[model samples]
Target: MGRKAKFNEGVIVRKGPGKKAKKTERSNFSKKLDSQHQKHRARKRLQKIKERQDKQKLLSEKKKKLDRIQRKELSKKQTEEESEVESEEDESEEIKILPSKGYSDDNKLWLKPKQKWIVQNENINDDESDDNGEGDSDTEDDHDDVNNEVEDEEEESDDDIEMENGKEELDDEEDSNLKVENLNDLSDDDSDDQDEFDSENEKSDKDVDDLLPIEKQNIKLKKKQAKDQKLADEEMQLNIANQEVFQFPIKESEEEIQSLQDVQQRIREVIAVLTDFKKLRDKTHSRSEYLDILKKDLCTYYSYNEYLMEKFMQLFPHSELLEFLEASEVQRPLTIRTNSLKTRRRDLAQALINRGVNLDPIGKWSKVGLVVYSSQVPMGATPEYLAGHYIIQGASSLLPVMALAPQENERILDMSAAPGGKASHIAAVMKNTGVLFANDINKDRIKAVVGNFHRLGVVNSVITCMDGRKYPDVLKGFDRALLDAPCTGTGVVAKDQSVKTSKDQQDIQRCYNLQRQLLLATIDCVNAKSATGGYIVYSTCSVLPEENEWVIDFALKKRNVKLVDTGLEFGTEGFTSYRQFRFHPTMKLTRRFYPHTHNMDGFFVAKLKKFSNLIPKSADHDEVTEENVENEKK
Candidate 1:
């Protein structure tokens, strides 16, 4: 402000102590220009840096995505390889290893000579022929050729004999000129020959007479009987071939020894012959033959699908797998649990026995459970069953309620209760004094639940058709809860063979998810604290580890629960690990009933105790989020 500005020749200068100073207006303008340039440079630099950062970020994200995809592909490849290895191992284990020897020819039962029975039809007219005879001429020609060849040879021999006799007569006449003796001999010979010819003609006439229509019909009936007999003999041979066990022959030279591949080939050939499945590619084969081939090709011991067989071998040892295969081939014994509320065990046993039902007590663990070894009448239609004195139930289905141990005057909940076997058992155990809520998601199945409950004289049970997973929100404080969750039914394959092919790995995963939901809901519904601690019994009619131990593992993490021993000593311990999955160590306390080991359906039962009343935080958040979304939509 104190210095005045002056300009000269497009330049301005001011006097100062040290040197010429520029004018304030010009200097200020130049400074402003410089500051603007600096700011522009800084903005460009910042923009370049930002662009570099964005490019790097994009590259990083792309690399991360590629890594994820690669990881997934690697894992999938590993899983496939592992599964292949496991299957190979299972096959090597299950298929009986042939010794250094070849298959035995000891009995040669499978090599029985084919027998062809020819039923001679004496009444068949040589002149008669049916219209279809042209098409079947090959078969008929075979018979005609045999008969004509024998008759032609016999006629030629008889002519030669006659020629020889004529020569002998001529020689006798020439040597001895005794006309009377010769004449008498010729007459006798001619008479004898005439008699023989007459007898032959009479027999031929009789045979022709037997060729009438009625006689021909009788001959055809005999042929039919002969054909049936041949078939019966063939069937008997096949049965013997199947029953006779043979061993492989040992060879001194190891180089010529039969390997597993050769043994498998031999087995396949034997099975094909036994089952009459010779032409697998034949389109005209029956369904039964096709099914036999499919079963034989799938496994050496069982008719299970490849996946199921592999899983079974993975789950059990070779000996147990054999037992399981044998057990699955036979029907499970019909078992009944007496309704204690309706009849006592002793009385029901006596009543059933009187009704021609052979009953054997199941075990010392259950007084009311009876294994029906034989029943003359339909056990389900019997008067005792109709009167609710007893209810037909699988031995495995009774384990959950036995583990539950419901008391009188206590509230119990059965989640996913349909066809109410376990629920009825629970009610009977409670002596019909407690309130039992039996719930199912399906309305149609609920009808069955109601029917079974009514038939079993279950008075305290209340049926509801609703999703069991929603029960924790609407109902609470049940003294005990049973979640016999719906599963793939791998356990009851003995009863329902279709289960072998009806389910797959995806179905198991779906069941696993549903079971987890139902289990969590059951935990919430049961009382947390009681005089007698509240219990939740989780059961599944499946032998799959994903549905049993893995589900328990998930519940242990998500819910405030702990597993306890079910006090059942009949079954083996639960699986602690399967494949890549590892379960809690305490899961061993759960019980696994195998059909081969326990003489029951494959079943899994886990008894859990809830010590905390706290609700899961995730559930609350989920509910809140759902409410907010609904409100916003409205």
Candidate 2:
């Protein structure tokens, strides 16, 4: 060591290499570990955590014991006689254990457990307690009691917020003997500390036991009673917390949440409770108590997070939110479009009708569309379908092509066309006369487009697999274009339930960014002035304002394009302004369809006329804007 030090006295020393960690040490679990081994490790980990919690509890109890002893000593020095008299009075007071109505000796009012006052156990006897497996009957009883109250005559007056059925001071008709103490300190903070608190109280009780005569030997019985009382208190506190926060919120102003996990009118009832909590809730309950119940209910019923629920709440009115959620739970009606290039609509309808399919013309606005009410044969596998008479699609899917109004013998671009539903619709409208470029980024998806084109007998279309955003670099100057942009699938939750919990704000942002880029590319690909068409119909199967209005507004600012009517009929007008974002007054020309209102998948379609071909050099979509959105149409 001395010789090495002499070699470089002023040189800085280098750090040794990091020690290698085993897979078990570095990661939570190893792939090599079997299921049984993993479960054993988890049990051991939980045991260690429990030991630590017990140690902390003992330490806290020791500190509390020391403080209590000191307080007793100080009190004795001030008033020894007063302390004796208080103990005598406490000894005289009896702990009468009642399993039923909680009336006092003189028949005073009882303060029920605010959260679970409605739930009661008619058979909570000694035998039931011995079994320890009959507790579910209690909750079942509570459900029946709440249901009865909900079905009773509606509350006309705003007075009884605490569920009093004309009983002078009683909070609820169902009551027990959970000592009617102060209801104000009903916080869920110390529910887990009941054991520690009970131990401390029992120690003090033992001191009183030592002073009593030997003839009165019911000390053990008293201890058992004390333990039972503490158990009831702990159980009551847990009932107040996460036992389906929606369970009680199920009971609302008009109806209880009921089978909906309080989901049905649960939305309307929650809205009513939230809007007027002061009139709906008791004086002791906080506003968060109601909201937490609503959030938990929404999560359980819809499989969405609290953040997404808040976003939906902000977008729709309190009443509309209910309709929207209920609609998402149900399936959308089935519809299909006739391939004009392959067969006539009347001929196809007659053939399908003869095959035991119950269907009707979609609407007066669409001649080639049919709404299928019932189909005995598989709609996708029928002979007419294989011959390509109609393509299975949603009713809302027809709007964008109708808006585009593709003409025969004109060049057209389907910027994001995949699976060729809309692209084939476009080709059929043109009667296979024009050159149609059906481009999609995904190669696998374009296969479906090609298959549809061939089966539908669409002769005048070309397919390419390239990113839609790069279209301006590869191709340009089309007579008309359609960008059915990829989106968060917010409007189609009824079809794909996974979207309920899977989507969030980041998904929304990602979709909006992509839509803005693709829409701009679509405008760039279309000619400013064409004899037949100079339009781009932008669309998505999404209802969010961010993915719909926000993307269109951003494109308007970047490209020389103006909004035009979708040209068919019957859809809610797009918002000219939303939250802090504003668009030109003509933004109303865009159309919006909803599952609840239109009985279709949530959708949006906007037709824009390109006025010039010049594109802005640089524009960022990340900026948060707060522009004027005043006097928006209802």
Candidate 3:
């Protein structure tokens, strides 16, 4: 305590020295304040740096958004360009390229020519018996015509013709030498007055817009200018065409052409099946009876008798087939094939029942077929369709598969299996147990076949995309085969109008060759073994003899295939034999369902069986004779 008191009171230094020490302490404190101020300044600089970064970030974000919008616009433009290119490509691809298949290429179907009989006016010469009488008759006819023409010209000269017959008559006969020179001056005065009145009326209408502002006035002025220009153009046309219209002599052929049109209109009035070539050749009926029957049937089904008559005349231009078509009874109880691929027959029937579609099952020696009545509900849009349970097929389409009668566990080939209607049916007939090689030349149609198989729950099918002619090489020997040869679907003309537009003899011939080749390929697939040898069904939707019988005959000679009796109720026995079947549009209980007949699509189906070991020993070896080689070289 004593040392502390001495330090506080007695250990005092000199005043000057204490003052120097205090100054030093104050200098240190001032140095500390300077460092604190420097630190605050650094913190302020850091804050300014952070603020500048944030501002830059905001600008970058705005720029990014603008860039995104520009990119979207650019992308949209690119997409439009791509779509345009794709559209052009699609348009180009729409034109079908003919395949190199020799069959279809040779058997191209052609349209029936517009047959015109040259009228060989048989004026018996006999040095022309009684030439004076003929000459006098001709002169008298000319005199009568000239007199009538002169009278007509006089009638036209009378101004009363216009008053009596109206403006249309005056215009029609403007070429007649009526001599209206006196009326021209009056017509010109009337035209000038009309133009002046129209201009005055236009000016009066403009007053309503005169009070408007300049912009509005300008808009109105543009519209008025457009209207006035159009009026002036029309007036100019009228002034230039003031001359009278001309007339020409009425032609005899013109009258005939008009008559044909009238006949067509009359035929449309009848609603009968007008195309039954087979019936036309029948010897049992009279021509008048045929015509009356056809007329009656047309009247029964269609409302337009005139149209039916016209079509009848056009179809039977020479009246050779008219009697036959008229007499032939239109088929009853139309047959509709069940698309087994999409749906089952039983299921479709039930669905139809639910939809109030009256369907009656056709019986005896047939697979699934039906007689369905009309309905307000569209059958195509039914739930059964969406479920892939059924396809609206033709009874004739069912014929080939039924004829083949595919057995379980057999390998079969279907050439040209597009739309898979028949392919799926064949699978069904095989009880979904056999291996099916279904092929089509068209790749786009492949999807349809696959879809059909999927819907049908088919498991034993392998779809291939290739021309049917090449199928023999790809798929070797099959147990059974079906070649629904591509023909000019003449049998189905009743359903599609476009088919008729392209129908011709040349087209049928092309189809014939294609059918023959397809049949040959199908025959190759047929096995010549087992107790019941394999069968091949060669079919077409064609009615031409060349495409049908001629093709079958050729195949018979080439492949030694025997025709099997179809035992159908509708068609007459085939022209060649009972083993072959023919279904005419006019026949009863057959599958050639014409609109005028059963109100159904036209179709044809033929079934043939391949005998075991039927191929001759010589067939195994090449028989290229010198003559044949020469012919080939030629």
Candidate 4:
């Protein structure tokens, strides 16, 4: 039909255009090569996976075998030791019970029943005394000590009186030899002097006898006072010396540096300096210089980056910053929220108490909260937990849901709900009467909500996985919205200490930008004209103002919403102005909870009442997004 092939090297061309050229197709060789390459890759991938799994299995089995051998050896050793103890017991004579004085049976008398004074109250101190069987012995010993002291004093007084009487007799004989009829007037004068001396000596003797017992007590009191004064003086001197240490005291400055190279003592010295800068730090150094060194020491000690330390110092006053840092290191109380849908708080607490769970109601501020001080059973694996009677949640997590105040039959949306804490709370508050859409971006995170919702029997929840920024397109017009945005987790450092060194300024900036975007989307998604409620609760586990106040301020100008009280009974009022940044005066309506002050995670909650759906022109954000929405739809 057409001219055949051109003779150019390995190129065949259809020269005539009689028929439309067919689309070029891969050669059989190339197709076969691609199939072979794909098969090779798949096989290689499977082989690598199998090898890794095999290695893990081998390691695990080896570890189990070693553990089993160790356990058997330990059991054998324990049994041998126990058997040795039993054989020794069999060979030894019967043990005799000794008296409270630790008396042996070398010359023991016949046994007789003895009386012990019964304690009327079960005070711990009294119980300890009774347990040692020394209650009566201690009292008798005290009485004996007093009697001995009195007897010793009486013996000394009697010896002194006899010595004085002998001295007077010798003096009288000497006077009788000297004065006779040699001088009659001298005798009268000498006799009068002797009578006066005798009268004074008798008066002194009478006073000594009267005050003999009390004098010993006075001496003992004086000794005790002297010891106490010495201790006080030593403490004062030590404090002064501590104040005079160079930078800080850790053996020597060089040794201190060497000690600091080790983590064990570095943190100790760092905390000491932070707690008592005036006393623990060198007096020669200026406060500013001390703080500079302290900042570095704190970073090294607590494993924090410099930026986060500066951020906290800026947030709190100089004195409270250490408190906040210390609080971050301590664990928050293990708290659980009772599920009212299934059980009452009283009944649930009773059931847990019966199972040897040491618990108490959390505080007056909460009706459904319980704090678990100790537990014989794992918190998450308890029968009551499996039965869905309660949830182990942070006390701070309860605040956002409380602030949102979800009502019955009202549509609610948890824009970033995962693990379903706040969402379940909202569902319970609504009594499962209203629809709740719990959406999170991560599919893996959404899986957690599934377990919680099922366990808690939450019926009115629709779990969705999508970007919160794109929430408005699929689900619009929520009666109320809760945005517990992802944050730097500054408030929950106690729960996750890795946040200290892992976070940076860039992280804060990234979180700030994300929070702003999410807050705008949250406000836009809520139905401002709802009859019952048009509230949005914005909260974060971060105490940073950039993630909290600044973001809230941004929303205030961009959306038609005003700040309102959270209705929570307690929390520090949000900062109206921090450092150089000033926020709306009504920012006080927002609440802050801190670990140091409130004994909870550092949290911020703000309730905003949306009056209208219209956004401000200053928010070119909505305008641009709206145009994009139209373009995408078209």
Best by TM-score: 4
lDDT of each: 0.68, 0.71, 0.55, 0.75
Which model, 1 or 2, shows the larger TM-score?
2
lDDT of 2: 0.71
lDDT of 2 by residue, 1-634 (tens): 4545487778899976555642335556546756888899999999989977876675566557556655654564346334334543433322232332422222223222111232233444443233222223333343353333222111211112212221221222124533333445533433223334335344322233222233124655666799999999999998977444232432453253347643645655666767776666555667777666666667767778777787787778767887988898889888999888878889999999999999999899999999999999999999999999989998888989999998889999998888899999998888889799999999899999989989999889889988887788998879999999999888998888888778887777767877877887889899997877889999999888888988888888888989887896899999987777777788888999988998999999999998887765553532422111111111
- Which residue pairs clash within candidate 4? none
Candidate 1 or 3, higher lDDT? 1
- The regions of model 2 sitting more than 4 angstroms off are 1-268, 275-292, 618-634
Ranking by lDDT: 4, 2, 1, 3
Give the worst 10-residue stretch by lDDT in candidate 2. 625-634
The global Cα lDDT (0 to 1) of model 1 is 0.68
Q: Which pairs, if any, clash in model 2?
A: 250-257, 257-262, 260-263
Q: Give per-residue CA lDDT, model 1, range 87-152, as digits (tens).
A: 443332221112212222221111111111122223323321221132134333423433332233
Per-candidate TM equals: 0.52, 0.56, 0.45, 0.65
How many residue pairs in model 3 have overlapping backbones?
A: 54
Mark the regions of model 4 whose C-alpha exceeds 4 Å error after superposition: 1-153, 176-219, 234-256, 261-291, 619-634
In TM-score terms, candidate 4 sits at 0.65
